[model samples]
Target: MPDSVGKPRRYRELTGLRLGTLVDRLRESLLFLPTVMLISALVLAEFFDHLDHRKIGPVIPERFQFAPEVVTVLLSTIAGAMITAAAVVFSLLLISLHLVSRQFSPRVLRGFWRDRFSHLLIGLLLSTFAFCVVALARVDVAQEFAPPYTVLFALVLTLGSVLGIVAYLDRVIRQQYIGNIMRRVLAESLYLIAGLPYGRHSGGQVGEPVTPPEPGSLGPSLVITAPFDGWVQQISRRGLMTAVPEGTVIRLETRVGAYLTKDTPLVTLWPPPPADQQHRIGQLVARSVVTAAARSMQHDIDFGIRQLNDLALRGLSDVNDPTTAAEAVARLGSLMRPLLMADLPARSVRDESGRVLLTPNDLDHAAYVRHAFDQINVYSADHPLVRETVTETIRMLQAASAGLPGREAARAELDRHLGTSRRHPLLTQAARADHFRSGDRRPRWRSATTRTG
Candidate 1:
């Protein structure tokens, strides 16, 4: 009904069909790879049958020959096994998701759902069944076109599928351990951060004002509104640069993780478009900004932090596993340190004319530090090991804040956590220092730093 339906397609639709994001989605999907493998196997089975037609006499040697009823029974059984295997794999995976979501943070399920090995194994079972179907169809006693090798290939596929089941089961069992999930999430998170432009570990820009400039008070700008309701996920910088007219600077009001409904202002076009280009400008903007129903780790680093925090929170549950919670807090520290040390990712993109075409809003570091450490700190206060880990993590972060923009936020948080619960008899003589006197070590996580006396 609204202009949301308008289109002038470019590289790909905003439905996450971008080559990079698609590759990620493919890894999460259990159907694609195995389907491709099964199709190839089927084609090969048929081709191999035709090629060796002369070698095998009619009736396919008693050893390989499969009577119609036997072929029917075998194919049916294989198909049944595939369904059973799929059910088992899916059930185990679903249970894993439930356990982690309940025990850990619900957000971490993305990490578990994207298990590529699990996806591949399940796909293999289905594809193997497909191979059998093709192979069985080639067995025709009437025309004497029994494929001896095809039957053999089917038998081999069945064996591989069985082995796959074993491998899948082993992986599922091992992954049930919280430590494994955290490690995978942490490793992948670092890997994700390394690819980001603001990357500190990979040697990108550092020690500067990583914040995007505030909108100028003097400029009156044109506001671009959302045409539909959805979660803002990604923006194609190259497409924005290519689509916008020369000599215009586009400033985004919405960050990557915002949810928008119809008529919500998304971008502010400086030097608003000439009247002639106004109608199509909305379409161009829509083409570049991608939206979806759920948040993804595809573009949001905060999503990664949320996942790790989930793990840490679950450990702090009344189940009395302070060690697990501490482990998560430590990993969260490592993840946050890099971002705090790195510059904000570049937001500006340009065109052939050297005009700034777009500048998406850059998120604040203060929010990240809070999100990374806040909840765990509150939950860990009663648990000494978890509290020490938090203090140790804060101390580590405090040492890094020397010249960083939000360094004070870190210091203030550390100072605030000190006053949280000093009544503990464990406070030693050294703990009596001013730093430990106040419950400031917890610093108002997620809150702005207060320059208190």
Candidate 2:
């Protein structure tokens, strides 16, 4: 039907395929079959060499026995095969890790050692089984064919080398290379997706009522304006007017793109109008009302910035002084919380029905407050203050939970805070509610707040 729906679906499918390709590449590299073959060959060669040196009879005399020159040739061939196998395995593992890490999370690959342990053990078992099968097969071929006593030595060397290589490759792949490559790929992909042409697709869904702009279409439609007539002043880009005009300018009370209300001025005739000029002023009185609202808003913003800067400076000054720093950090957290709360994305806190509204400013303020708390935590990781703040945040979350008429959310936030130790009271509160005693009404907590002087 609509191109809007079709385009997003197509993009998603392509993105999914790209991710799958990455995973396939990773699996091939990490689990190359050639490596296994080389490993088997190396074990076989080592077993024969050990048997010959120990004067132990071969398990397969006719097929495998050789003179000194032939033994030298065989050993060289086996060595080459083992090296080839290792190279193949390592190269594939590196490439796969690089590609998969780019498309997905590195955390997903965390348990590689544990997961691959069973496979390695199975490989060892199969190698032993194959040796036994060969021994049985060679029983009628020659009297010299018997069990190789050096099998134990060969087994150790083969398994040890494989393990060492795997460990080295795993470390190099996961730690040094994969994460950086993956991060870059993900960032670029996200940027590309965001840059794609998608027309006026509102994040808002259908059936929502859109609020239209206020009436009076053209130039300032109001008649009666501000009582104190001044020159035209600074106007916002969006047409919100501020009464901060220069003294020399004298023009109409209204400008193009300015909003008109019941109290907005109509004209500013040159020279002074006598008090007797109140004759036509009655006509101007009934039109509109536009007060100086922008000035007040600007003042509040400036004041807020100044206060934040001052608090930040104070905290910095007390950095070396633990006690003072703690107090300053706490204040900063309190101040920043409101600012962050005011800045959060409205959609994040809003309910599905969209009836519940949350202000972006509130969210933003909360985030800043959380950041301040994080700084505090970092500063006091080994100190008692961290525990104190953690406890305080829990208390705040508890209060919020109680206010909301549920302990579930508060408990979740507390648990999350315990794990992360990062500040963000609302997040902690929400996470706590979700995690702790999901349906339990009573506030159940084992840890008591340890007071810090």
Among these predictions, the greatest TM-score belongs to 1
Candidate 2 TM-score versus the reference? 0.23
**Predicted candidate 2 versus true structure: per-residue lDDT over 1-453, tens digit per residue:** 112333344344434434543443443342443358446745775566566457775354354333334333433444454456555654655566565444333432432322354334334434443443343333332333333343333345446656755665565455334234333323322332232122111112211222322223223322324554332212111011111111111224443123344445554322223345333432322122222322111112222222323333333343433443444444433433333222112222222222211112211222333433444433343344444654565455444434332234334444444444345443334333533565664533223112321
Q: What is the lDDT of residue 445 in candidate 2?
A: 21
Best by lDDT: 1
lDDT of 1 by residue, 260-282 (tens): 78798877776677777776777
TM-score of 1: 0.77
Q: Give lDDT: candidate 2, residue 264.
A: 58
lDDT of each structure?
Answer: 0.65, 0.36
How many steric clashes between backbone atoms does each model show? Answer: 21, 49
Candidate 1 CA-lDDT value:
0.65
